[model samples]
Target: MREQLQELLEQRVLQCVSMPRNQLHECPGIELKKQSCAKRSAEIVKAKANGRIKRKFENQENESVLYEVHFQYLIKQRGLFYMEEEVEKRQVEFYKGILVSDEKLNEIDGPREDVEDIPVFSGHEEGQERKGFRYDRMKAVQYAERWWNDFNPAYKKFEVDCTNYISQCLHAGGGPMRGYPNRSNGWWMQNNNWSFSWTVANAMRWYLPGSKFGLRGRAVDSAEQLKLGDVICYDFQGDGRFDHTTIVTGHDGNGMPLVNAHTYNSRMRYWAYEDSTAYTPNIKYKFITITDDSDA
Candidate 1:
């Protein structure tokens, strides 16, 4: 099922990439490039908001470009039934917050009663396109900014909210939530409005955080002991400050944690954990575990 699903997702992505932009619009429109999906999605919402488009569901020839067949299935099984409504609803609340209408809310109150509301398509990935793929967090942040802006801004926002932002990107990138938490549900929370714990720890499964094991585990006896996707926790000035967090997106050939964080600054960047920019020598470190949810 995973293989089939992955294949379907790949094919959809390729189709979106290979399909001509002009062919993607229902009406005569501009050509959409790979970098423009997020921007376009933002524009669609903006146009609807400005009354340029009278319809909620704009006729999108390129809808096929942004999604995969497997994603559609996942949507039916996971996101779609709730996505259009949930995303619209949350986006409005995040943006407008309590000022949105009860009448508009009523429209999506019930389940999609008709299975026909579900779309159908064969799914498969064409070939390997992972070669050119780089972890372009800056571009991801740009897309995210446009996305977050179209909605309400009352919900807690973070700079190096890398994990949270990545979660959003994954959703935008066509990954289904297997049981993740958002700020609303509180699967994760911030500390004093600015702290991080960029590792995953299920209370039901792991003890005292970082107890859950498997993806990749290593002891960071020194700064040299980290790699991509590895986690970093804070220990404030030896008084035990597990008060901050970040993730390692890459590493130097010598092995240093390339971190992406917010707080001090909002950006995906590289850092030396042992260096005392944010700490002192008495500040001890813990395990920098890793998890690759990509193939999952």
Candidate 2:
């Protein structure tokens, strides 16, 4: 079942990549549109099975299964005469399911839904200082701006190091670690090992809101509301699967957030990320307001 689902997703990705601009408007289950910009190219970064659900058929030998796959890709564009290139990161969810027959599968409604609304996190208690220590935001931003290009030798680095770098900045700014020895929960790093929240984008999404004592964050409505030392998470595919993270270091003259990130190593870059190939019209964002223990 998993293999079949994977094959189906791969085929859809190929279709999106090969379909011409004229035909993209007519393609089913695919979204392609021309931007105001010129030049064009496409690339798939990765795809993976995230989860599954099974429903039993009454008195039947078989069951219905729904599989969720996360797909990440990039689209690049340039002017007709200009050599400069801009890339947008994109992600989309593909659902593959098996029923009694192809007819039954065809009867499923909508097959997919728009990006799920971000879960709401409760506000901090009135006048109550949060538990744990606080780090200096200026220091965290300094670290991010200073080390985005240089690797910190203290921790292990991966080819995809965005989340790891963000975690370091948050720590430097005084976010405390919890749930040590349990990689599935908490945010901690010791001896080259770290929690999933410290290293994975999706895990950190849940961790920040669910945390009670360490590394808590309050969700804001938009990027404009985020302050320096805050964080932004991206779901290029709008599938509720966050794949990238960045730290706010400064705001532009227009008060737009400017961020620093690793993996691609950007410094004081614009937060909108319109230049990334992974970007899409359906992109989703999470603006996090890091809570400090010193606030009362």
Candidate 3:
């Protein structure tokens, strides 16, 4: 039974690379159907999947087993003027050696709502010109690439960790932290506790422009205006609430951003997220350009 499960897991891992058109993360118990996107032209040149058993147990009648697998994907992609490789990962659950559900592990845990009001920094003069820290785009991008599919021991890993991961990348770029102990105000993570803006997608999306000190960002009109180390907020439901976040780590030949995220564990993925299972035609985005003292 173990061997049979292992073989099935391996075959399922390899199967994701076989169909690139859909790219949508499959929910448990649903067969992924290919959907056409007009802007998708990048071709996947090669692909492979690797899976490992995370846990397993016997079912009620002992007729089958229930278990979880950590599935990882390696893909080589080609575009009009570029060729690059990416490593993406997700988790899957199986019952009785049959695939039941597959998705980014803990998709339900992330992208929290804005439950608290962050107070404004009294020391900051909103209208007055202020010099900020130098944001290192290269360092941020490097950090994104280094840990896209892995978790750092310094921080707590969440089941839905998109915003937390993006905050780490911003910190790598020299974004300062303030408002410790005040979980509703400012953006700082300390002693296993963090501000809403530090870990919540909706909070960060709102806190960026209004913030006067520490990890501030200016709202942008389009994704194209963004450069490396910038952030993008996703309102997947298009109900005026943000649910996910990603960082710009690279770009495609057409100058579109190639983002890295944690929840789905994607690397060098298209910024539009048309491939995401959460994608909807009504989906909206908030583009943020990380500003530094040089902006003055």
Candidate 4:
């Protein structure tokens, strides 16, 4: 019975996580989807000579173009979420829900097939219904830990500098790089001259030329349009200079966006988008977008 239970868990690990095959983190992975703007586009309205309105045949094409980055998220398997109810239930079921061991439940020295009460969780439900909801702050932090674990230590120590570390976290989350080379740029290369593009600004720019990874780059406006893995760069001085980069993890309870960034004060932390009061004084322009360099 015990052996059978172990096998079930192993299978659950594959279905819920699906990491090794997809290059996804076992804990949480970022996903992107299109979000449209609520406000009508300027092209949709026509101004009359007398300030009167007129209906013009503006195509739906412009409506689709009026999208902005409004949603950000980090998705994970439902089974991995630390639900006390589920945990206790599984323990009880595993031990046959009694103080004295029940040989009947473990007749084959493994889990019993009759343990139907055990919670079965999945990331997505049937017909595209989402099984798991947005993870919370604590889960996001845990996801960061999983992300740290998945990073190759050799690459982390040798190829990544301080700025590159921040960039790498964002890259793993889904922000793609551009100008970064995978080979032979001694200063930026490691592991046989594979140098990583460094700094938040430089790393943001790296996607301009595209890399070996298959990453696609697109310019977007507003944090709301961003998905969990999108990269957001800020021109802190509003002088057309992008000085900072951060990765969007997901949304908070109030629909405020959350971001993960490093090196500003040395530790990676989540920042809320609505709390502009903290850094709005220095922020000039905010550009959020999704880039995919996986092809390179």
- Which candidate leads the pack in lDDT? 3
**Count of clashes in candidate 2:** 18
Candidate 3: RMSD to truth:
4.7
Task: Give a tens-digit lDDT track for model 1, residues 157-276.
Answer: 543233444334322333222212222111223342411212221111121133222122334565566544444555445553243454555443334444544333222233433322
For candidate 2, which ten residues in a row score worst on lDDT?
79-88
lDDT of each: 0.31, 0.62, 0.68, 0.33
TM-scores, all candidates, are 0.32, 0.57, 0.77, 0.37
Cα miss at 151, model 2 (Å)?
Answer: 0.6
What are the clashing pairs of model 3? Answer: 28-101
TM-score result, candidate 1: 0.32
TM-score of 2: 0.57
Q: Write the per-residue lDDT of candidate 4 for residues 99-186, one digit (tens) a residue.
A: 2221111101122112222221111223432221222324333444354323435454422132354445544443322222432121
Residue 278, model 4, lDDT:
25
Deviation (Å) of 111 in candidate 2: 24
Q: What range of 10 consecutive residues in model 4 has the weakest lDDT sum?
A: 31-40
lDDT of 4: 0.33
Clashing pairs in 1: 11-125, 24-62, 75-80, 94-152, 95-151, 95-152, 160-261, 160-262, 236-241
Q: Can you tell me which runs of candidate 4 are displaced by over 4 Å? A: 1-152, 156-163, 170-189, 192-200, 206-213, 264-282, 291-296
> Between prediction 2 and prediction 3, which has the larger lDDT?
3
Q: lDDT: which is higher, 1 or 2?
A: 2
